[model samples]
Target chain A: MDTAVLAGEIMQRSGAETYRVEDTMSHIMRKSHATRIETSAFTTMLLVSLQEEGRQPLTVVRRVHKRGMNLDRIVHVNEISRKLCGDSLSLEEAYAELKAIEQESQKLYRPITYQAATLLTVIGFAVFFGGTWLDIIGGGIVGAVLVGINLLGKKLRFNNVFQDISASIGIALMGIILKQYVFWNMNLETVIISGIMPLVPGIAITNAVRDTLMGDYLSGAARILEAFMQAAAVAVGIGVGIVIASALIGEKVLL
Target chain B: MILKIIGVFIAIVAYSVIIETPRRFLWLSGLVSAVGGAVFVVCNEAWRMDMVLASFWSALGIALLSHIFARAFRAPVTLFLVAGILPTVPGAGMYRTVYYLILGDASMSSFYLTQTLEVAGVIALAIFLMDSVSRIFLKRDVGTQPWTKERNMDKKQEEK
Candidate 1:
């Protein structure tokens, strides 16, 4: 029971789909010869109950928070569940592996690599969008500023919405400055769009649609709303930044 | 077009790193994204297809590849889908929608808004279609149905 709960919690926190979470938990519980196993996973809640022909039932309800994208954890947990279902892994071994995954949750790549990824993503998308050399250079600098702001946001413990907003505002300001002084012919649209690619909710939106298609309405609705909130935050931030920067520069450079 | 494809491949690989995908699978994920990017480019530029249709085809290719890679590598489909779907996500459309709204250009805002929603819907359709197709070809239902007595009996027989 503990193993199943831990596995579900790990998967949920790592941003597995609700159906996948429930399926994995049910599979894990079935190994114990539970006559009735019920596992239901919502966006923010996970519940697994098992009742045999015994005197009592076992139920675990874990309120999951702090969801993030960690595909490695999802793959690992899925593998563990498959092994457990195949009877190759004992319950204790599965539990221990899950605990290790949970404990090593903070084991992301180095901070420097994350910053480099942000930089490369912006530059690559800028080029993909058909930016010229000037646009690519300008996008690279904006990407650098974005990474700096992101690191600072982490240090200051900014909320997700605020972090996106600030990063976007910084992008807009940088784009305007580059257009005004540095890269005169640079495409502001291309640079800003590429810079904000890292902040967009592509994964969230996809997962939301998938969940809805899979008939998990609650999680789907919640995720769709979350994605909208994130998009709105980014839009509002860019609008405000463009307004502020254009006002400072004494012209209407962008909408 | 070649440059664009390379750029998209690099972008997708970097995105996989940010999302903490398993390092061992990054190259495969990038290849899937590159294939989608190539399809989109051919449809949009060479064939002069509508942007929405191009996005649909691109997403369809990515979803198909993701499902195949999942089966081949024994990994979750989300690993590839989450990273490979980046190129067609309509970020520029979403930006334009709100940008026009802020400028009080209600017509343009609504125009881009409709386009953005259309792209999103079509991407969803593509993923759904691929998912159903894969399920049809695979063994047994892979959904969240509870275990049945028949399945248990089969397992016991196999053990015997």
Candidate 2:
């Protein structure tokens, strides 16, 4: 098709702003046909396109800004001429749409809570280590508490990774105390699992393996590398604990 | 039975909450997890009953079920894997191997390597069998295979 028609089609399909419609079209034109677009403009346009394609947005966002000039001021004289002749979206509908958009964005931005994670991890460890049913159940309860505290910490805008690491260490100390003071042979597995459960990259490693087997060489390698890095992070935490415990107590105190 | 079911429930709840799935589909996921755990329980008992036959049958069963779940859920294969594979993941086995290393129990590195390979082989076999059945029966044709001219067109787009 001709350039103008292509521009119009891309604009309609992508929901590109009237002003940016021409620029994005030119960008697409300059790139090879095989090139996949990754620009923010293209991504926004693509999301809009998906909406136009009848896919309901699982989340939505709406933003209004004072750009220091009105649309009528910046718009073309001919566009103003058309606006005088025609009408468009109602203000109320725009506001409603924006509200939905904000809700969607909030959902996407929600971080994983550590409450349920820690409790479940501890319970898993207890049960797997053959702890009594009560001990196992107690571990689950602890995990729930950890998840709750984690969520609260996030809501309070606390440090992200630091909160996580501290909570994990806190849970570990609880386990150690219970073992040392309460149950002489208490299960450490529950504590360790609960504490480190969130950091395990099990799914990532599994997908990496599956992708490699299926010959998705590029995606596979990328995922596999990510899996190892996450694994290394978990290992480093363990190593650091061991090193610190060794120096302070002069014994293997990180049981 | 109920206790085992509870363990399975815990697994599913833990995975979903940990993975951040919404509450809507969690019940469905829980039921699926319970079923997965029960399957492993049977498989484990059977393996104890007869190692050779049970291993063959269990491997075959897991492959069939895995492919079915992958197609039905339209979820990534990893989800089914995390749920179903856990019962058989040999986490305890790995821990034992780790403990042996920490305690310096014999020249255990080679032994642990063998154990690791055994675990790897089982996983590899399960995946291969699942993929093959998927190709043969379902003919779902994942991977880079070109089933038709139109499908091949998609590859042409991706290759660039």
Backbone clashes in candidate 1 total 0
Best by TM-score: 1
Among these predictions, the greatest DockQ belongs to 1
Cα lDDT tens digits for candidate 1, A83-137: 8876899999999999999898466688788889989999999989999999889
Candidate 2 per-residue lDDT over residues A1-255, each given as its tens digit? 122223323332322233233333323322224233222222122221212234442222222221111111111221221222223533344334333432343431134443444456456545533457546655665565566656777678655345554555444445444555566565655445544554545444445455566565554575556555554444344334434444555555444
For each candidate, the DockQ is 0.64, 0.15
For every candidate, what share of the true interface contacts is present? 0.69, 0.12
lDDT of 1 by residue, B33-87 (tens): 9999999999999999999999999999999999888877778888899899989
Indicate the TM-score of model 2. Answer: 0.57
Per-prediction TM-score, please?
0.95, 0.57
- How is the predicted docking of candidate 2 categorized under the CAPRI scheme? incorrect
